[model samples]
Target: MKAHPFLLHKWQHWLALGFGSGLAPKAPGTFGTLAALPLVWLLALISPLWAGVAIVAAALLGVYLCEVVSRDIGAEDHGAIVFDEIVGFAITLWAVPFNLQNVLLAFVLFRLLDILKPWPIRWFDRNLHGGLGVMMDDIVAGVLACLLLHSVWLPLQL
Candidate 1:
């Protein structure tokens, strides 16, 4: 089915929009990240291993979600398709043990890497296409955040 903007009735469109969090007119990505928090917190509570699993699952699901939503909306990587952001933030917090301080720091770090799109992140965003393209840059940002988080924490542990 060749869907369009008028098809707001579809579940895929809503899912793509991060269930309307991404519909925010200003800083939609920030809202999308905020929408990811509860899920992140819940998964984090289940233990670090489960949180990692959930992130992986969400990312795999995100590939399909982006593909479907972008196709349905007649665009690729639409601003409103933020399941990638959700998954990315989840990745940022993986294995961190999820205290409020850690999660907030991850949020800030992920947003910075994501918005700045440094290095390979920018390359992936500019060069890739389709659903995987939509997800790859954010995944890189999450990885960057993870590394930064660990670097800081490890020094403190030393």
Candidate 2:
């Protein structure tokens, strides 16, 4: 496909930017997440309970948005569409005790699970299609990461 007239044509720019992250060639997903970090920080500052609600809302909304944008791009699950990651990461951090240790651990764990796509994530990636397919794996990853983070956090709380 030709480079979009506006930011390389199509919604590629929007998608890459996490709808925009697609604009970046190098580590667009990472850049997208970085862009999302400020939002994360703002949400984190809220009571953790509220943060959890927001994460759920964001993830559900992301599914629809990611699907629409992914369809427009004619690519199933483009890497530039990192809304899944954004929502996933937010969910991973939600309600978890924040400290350098937990933050680092959650980041590593979320990335690992997201990249690995274990269990149902693998299933969703392979079996599902469209935007839901693109988003389901990340949701799975977020759940796994959240579980792991909670497991770690519970011990620390004692």
Taking every candidate in turn, the Cα RMSD to the unseen true structure, in Å, is: 3.2, 3.0
**56-120 in candidate 2: lDDT tens per residue?**
78777777776777666677777777887787777777787556787778778988887777887
Predict model 1's lDDT versus the native.
0.84
The candidate that achieves the highest TM-score relative to the unseen native structure? 1
Where in model 2 is the C-alpha error above 4 Å? 1-16
lDDT of 1 by residue, 1-158 (tens): 43336256777677778888987877878888889988887887787777788788888888888888888767899787888898888888777767878888999999999999999899999998888999999999999899999888768877
Ten-residue stretch with the least lDDT total in model 2: 4-13
Candidate with top lDDT is 1
Worst lDDT 10-window in candidate 1: 1-10
Clashes of each: 0, 13
